[model samples]
Target chain A: MKRLVILAVLIVFCSSMAYGDAYRVSMRWSAKPGYLRLVLESGEEIIKTARVYHSYSLVKVEFQSEFSFDYENTPDAVDISHKGSSLFININGLKDVKVFRLADPSRLVIDAEIEKTANAKTVPEEPVKPYGLSDVVMVIDPGHGGYSMGLVGSDYKEKDIVLSIARSLRYTAGQAGAKVFLTRSTDKYVSIDERINSTYKKKPDVFISLHMSSSPDFVVYYAKMDTSIRSKDRYMLKYSQLGHLGDSVKLSRVMAEVLREKFKRKVRIISMPLPLLSSIGSAAITIELPDGKYFDYNASNRYALVNTILKGIGKYER
Target chain B: MKDNRYLTALISILFILVLAGGYIYLIRMHPPEIAMENKTEPSSQPVTKPGSEEHISIKLFFPEGHKLVMEEREIPRVFSQKKILREVIREFLKGPAGTGPFIMPEGVILLSVYIGSDGVAYIDLSEDLRRNFHGDAIDEYLLLKGIYESTISNIKINDVKILIDDKEVDTIGGHFYANRPLKQLVTQEIKFD
Candidate 1:
């Protein structure tokens, strides 16, 4: 009888704890007169007809609506307040939330504890100067798009993998306060000439080309010859790193080091003659992520690689 | 008493098997084995056989119908006359014939060369060589480095210096710092678009 009673109490406690877990809320506000749009992660739509206000040097809108509760929280659920453009929110028991504002298709982001629910009253003030490293623009080039399949891995395509990683780097770098540009957002063929020309036009502080490796049939055969023999495919593909922009060895070295550290992968900085590297006076580094038969495209590995790149960009931020 | 002994013997066998399995598992999981398998391979092939066919003389050949006349000059041997540098250069230019699609560049015209006693070979280029070559700064640097380093390495020259019309230039086209001569290492191949 005593054990049965204790078991019932334990089950009730576990159920309540699970019910109290927080959930994400996102909303998009668009097509307003002055205010364009507001999007949240929760997928909730909040349309406001309030007048725009400028306080603390930020643009904000005020609206009166009943806040819908999506997740359970403690009695002192942290209240997020926004008066102008700036937003202020505190997690109940968490710190170090990453925030970002993407500009191309403007979106404000806030990552916090999801369980807490509170009404925000004041948006924080935008900083007088941007709070990131200034005068640094990173041009991320995802190698091989469209017709170019660029190193096919068993689990994923190299082009797709590189683009995803590049996009993540761009986001993290932007958060770190660096202007970032992608050579091509979608799958499209960018010629060697165009790739170099694009860098010249952007005049980016640094140019990073992301790529992956493929196991050629020769490599598979060679492996049979000596299981210990390293694949020559890596060396054969390394010829692609050569660019025709005027020589900037220092830039190449720095970029190589940063990429190697971030990806925790083996990289060869080939000093080869190519038109793209020659024409672009900017420091350019080509990053080749491990591909087919080399590395698995798992989420944890991807996260670690992305985080390493973010850390590398952070070093150059200031 | 017989049942007790049988049970004890069975237990002893099971204990030994478990101990052996754990030992093998620990050995497999050791960190050194992981690193030994994951080491990166060396980038460039190591140079061997100083004067072997592996170190072939690269010649620059003109198109079949082109009207550029050639004059034969005595081959200079910085170290020994037996290893003729001029004969190698002349043979390289006259041997291969192809324009695009992986052949050497047309504008890479080698003029006069001065071999130093210190195994440093100084090759002079025509004034039209720089104008004829079309590539970005890094590409040009790499191309020039490749041409110079490959020639020097095959010829057993230690260092290479580039000069245009017998005058020292800061850079080939104001891109690479060619003010000082470069030492020969691995020759980087240029991929032309």
Candidate 2:
């Protein structure tokens, strides 16, 4: 019986020797403006090198040194597991994942761009946003009018196409519970000054301008400072869009994502000094649709376009 | 005695060759001053014109289909950078003599050109410059690009800050940001063989 006990103790010692004491790592999480940040930290060893592999919803990190981490505080939308020598982080819903290493103390940072709607879904009955339609106001501008005939397409003029889209956005957005206004609802020339006046008076939460162009399928733009202005006028002009630049950038991202999905095309966002948008004191973006003559302007396409804009606004609000 | 004579002949021949080589090298390096003074090439599309100490080359750009085509011209060196700038604008305002639309509107006039100590050229234009403007984004971009490209083509000037009727407006048109100078535009495109 003594020999039997000795043999069991020897087996236990051999197994413990085979697997060295595991490194204790800590995992932390926080929600940023547009993404959820996950941080894994190891104090004793610097993670000098790591292989990161990500697909649709999973981010896997294989470390040079195997470590065990407590995933107690993992968000409802995410699952964390450690197996073998790899750490697997499963993000529930997202547009993208970025994994990078930070030093000073060893750490791996994971940023998952979660869809706003998906975020709300994860938290049941917890109202995450005060962004109902009635709380949010929007202004839509249709480029050109009457004497100023926008570029002509196969069956429609640019002015005509923009007016139709602007009108559709107003109705669709209104039905969605947002107070929406249009710079010009009819086929009339609304001067840039007039549009600026409309934005100034409306003081909306978001302002969207619609147009069409060739070559590029679709483009979204927010305000960029025009460094050309000088003196007292410079102060006023610079400040006009300064306060809303961040809002515009965030809004543009949501808009671009939704528009990209709807059109199944690359949606580019740029920051340029657009006189019309720059001079207006509002969070604004201009979306230029495809102006190709062969492009279809059917009713279903229009419906999708309107829904796309509304979806973008809804996501941004959330 | 024969060896001495052979050495002298070889030395004389070597000296003459060295003199001839130096003469040819100098002739290539410095053309006759008269010829250098007289040499001037009319700038055309895609061709850059070079100038000497006595003159400055004006490189102008004009809108074609989508992009601006560059044209270089030479003018006698002036006393002030502002004067040289005016000449450049004047050449641009004259329009492309060949074909296509004028990059600048017909009635638009340059009210003044002011060069700041920091090397930014503040170009003031008449209200007609803004009032007479009509086109889309491409037209607006090309118009500003031409003016900015031509002004910076001259040396000593760094950037271009555009003004309307002596005051800074948001932009010439509602498309691009104007109140700032076109400092970011390329001054030269160095092509290698």
Task: Tell me candidate 1's interface RMSD.
Answer: 14.0
Candidate 1 docking class: incorrect
lDDT, residue A89, candidate 2: 74
* Candidate 1 per-residue lDDT over residues A116-221, each given as its tens digit: 1111111122222243445578788876654444554334455556665666566656655778898865554566656766777787766776666332111000
| Candidate 2 regions with alpha-carbon error over 4 angstroms | A1-134, A153-155, A226-238, B1-56, B61-139, B155-173, B176-193
DockQ of every candidate: 0.04, 0.05
| lDDT, candidate 2, at A254 | 91
Report the CAPRI category for model 2. Answer: incorrect
lDDT of 2 by residue, A156-202 (tens): 55655666677667766675578899997654456777788888888
lDDT of 2 by residue, B49-125 (tens): 35466666677888786568887677676645567678888888888768776746588888888777566778888
How many Å off is the CA of B28 in candidate 2? 51
